[model samples]
Target chain A: MRHLTDDEIQGYLDNHPDSDREKIRAHLDICGQCRSNLENYQIIAGQLNTDHIPALSPGFTDAVLSAIKPDTQDVPVEEPSRLIAWMSAAAVFILGIASTIYFTGSSVAKNIIALFSPANITEPSFVSRYKEYISGIDLDLTLVFAVALVLAVIALIDRMIKRRHKPVSFMI
Target chain B: MDDKTSIVRKIVAGDKRAFRLLVDEYQRLVNHIAFRMVSNPGDREDICQDIFMRVYQNLAGFRHDSRLSTWIARIAYNCCIDYLNKNNIPFIDEEFDETISNMPGGSITPEQQLYKSDISNLLQKEIGLLPVKFRAIITLYHLDEMSYAEIGDIMSMPEGTVKNYLFRARRLLRDRLMLKYGEEELRQ
Candidate 1:
């Protein structure tokens, strides 16, 4: 008795493979067990193909609607951390100023210390020679402030220039 | 309330009453989908509630570009997928054959088959066990009777992708039935 290979069976099931149909039929004719199993499988397939979508039970929708419609009494208070953001920003600005002062002070103090020991310097160490070349760390406070003031004035002037186009109401 | 635009108008006017009407009408459709996508009844209810709650919260952002039903359906679709992902369910890929070959077809009587089924019930179970997207896509297409274009719009899938999913979902079902039951059972 000839038997069908798994591939041949799958080909028939999928119905596309190049397996010769007569060969499969002949094998099926000879093989009782494959035929039986195939029959069982086909029956099960038919049973499953029935499209019976279940109906929604009574009040199912109402129950779901109830779950959705809760009493709106509990309000989640919005944690407005705007003040916290402002406070943190203010803290950083203060810290930035403090760090600038401390850094400048330390740089100047180091230069002063390096200069005081100049007698012991023949080929001045990089630190002392750097200080000798420039007593300060070359911080031009006036120029720096002047540029900052100019930027502020330019920004203010630009804002005023833009403001003139505003549709202002001549309310008495 | 069933008129989609009217519901939106009423809902926008701070009408809690309007919301209840929308929730009442659409909750079945939402729950039907949610229940099919996720097997747990409780989770289904939770997802349904969340969808309505979201409808309330994001009402302001909704433009009148689309019908309210479609918009709400899109939201419910998203909410179900989100719920599935958050719960660690895997998305189904159209990668493998799911048909079982050894189903008992001839041995069982047609009467037995009919008596044994609530096909939709078994269908929900099988569909739920599929890759999550398969279940959602199938439910959206079949139970909701949504057009491919509407399904695509709701899912944000390309129309082609939605069509492929619709085909894959049916193929998966056929394959699953083939594996569990045989070809004759299908034809019968």
Candidate 2:
């Protein structure tokens, strides 16, 4: 009869389901070499099966807790309601500005053109009139509103992208 | 809600105490993976901290698809792999036989092998000489008491591969032990 392979011996000692224990036992009755191999593997497996976790540094939990304290900036996921609220705010702001421009007939583009015109610059009253123009013109408010809208849109897109690709450290 | 979901919710809600509880719960599992994969003594603690930080950072993304411990263990394993790569250590040593064959002989006597403590110490030493992947498989299997399926999930390998590597690692450890102190001595 052929001797048991090392895999067979180790598997038998490990109590592996695939190992035929009765047949191996019958074989062991006739084979001393395979039994010896099984005994050696048994010793090693016994040592390994015991819990032998290496010691971590004292206060490991404390250290990790403290390390994560300042670093745990939880970026809340944007809910649909919240996204809608932002969009609504942007829409209302734009609509309000458009309505003001439409109803008041304040032509911001025409004022800008008038301010930069050479004819307006060459006049002696240009500085005071320009100061008055700068103070009274709605272009500043419109410009401010437009800048704020651009910023808000950029921030919203950035948050969406971040949410979509939030650094998945390890996906199972 | 389940304990895991509750803790995860509390953690995601900026509850530091809940996060602390999580750290306390899974620190051993994380430390085991880190200690097995990372050889440097100093980097071990740092790597553990890094793993937890990543866990905290990404907890919101966890969808309860697996056990929390298994998920944290996966992070720890990946962090150690990153450390090994950054430090230019080959994660899988190609010439692993040289590692075993080159082990100094007769350094451990049969008398030393008689003591369980001595045998465990020698076993740890021999395990350290294994390739990185094998060492991790051994650690997760024996120390962590994880199933082959769970280990396969963490290491991103099939269950069969984990079992095979585990068998090979044990066989290698046995060979090394028998080489240092002969088979009859180990039977004692």
lDDT values of the candidates? 0.60, 0.79
Docking class of 1: incorrect
- Residue B77's lDDT within candidate 2 is 92
What tens digits encode model 1's per-residue C-alpha lDDT throughout B1-188? Answer: 44777777776665667877877777766766676666776566567767777877777678877766678888888888787789887655656444444322324456546633443444444565566666666666655666667778887889778766655555555555544445544445
Instruction: Estimate, for each residue in A15-47, the C-alpha lDDT of model 1 and write its tens digit.
Output: 524668887877778788777645543443343
Best by lDDT: 2
> Can you tell me the CAPRI class of model 2?
acceptable
iRMS (Å) per candidate? 11.6, 4.3
Candidate 2 C-alpha lDDT tens digits along A4-93: 988788678767788999999999998998888888887887888775766777798788776653433454444445665576577567
B60, model 2: CA deviation in Å?
Answer: 1.8
Once fitted onto the true fold, the runs of candidate 2 whose alpha carbons sit more than 4 angstroms away are A69-172, B98-100, B103-117
lDDT of 2: 0.79
> In order, what fnat does every candidate score?
0.11, 0.57
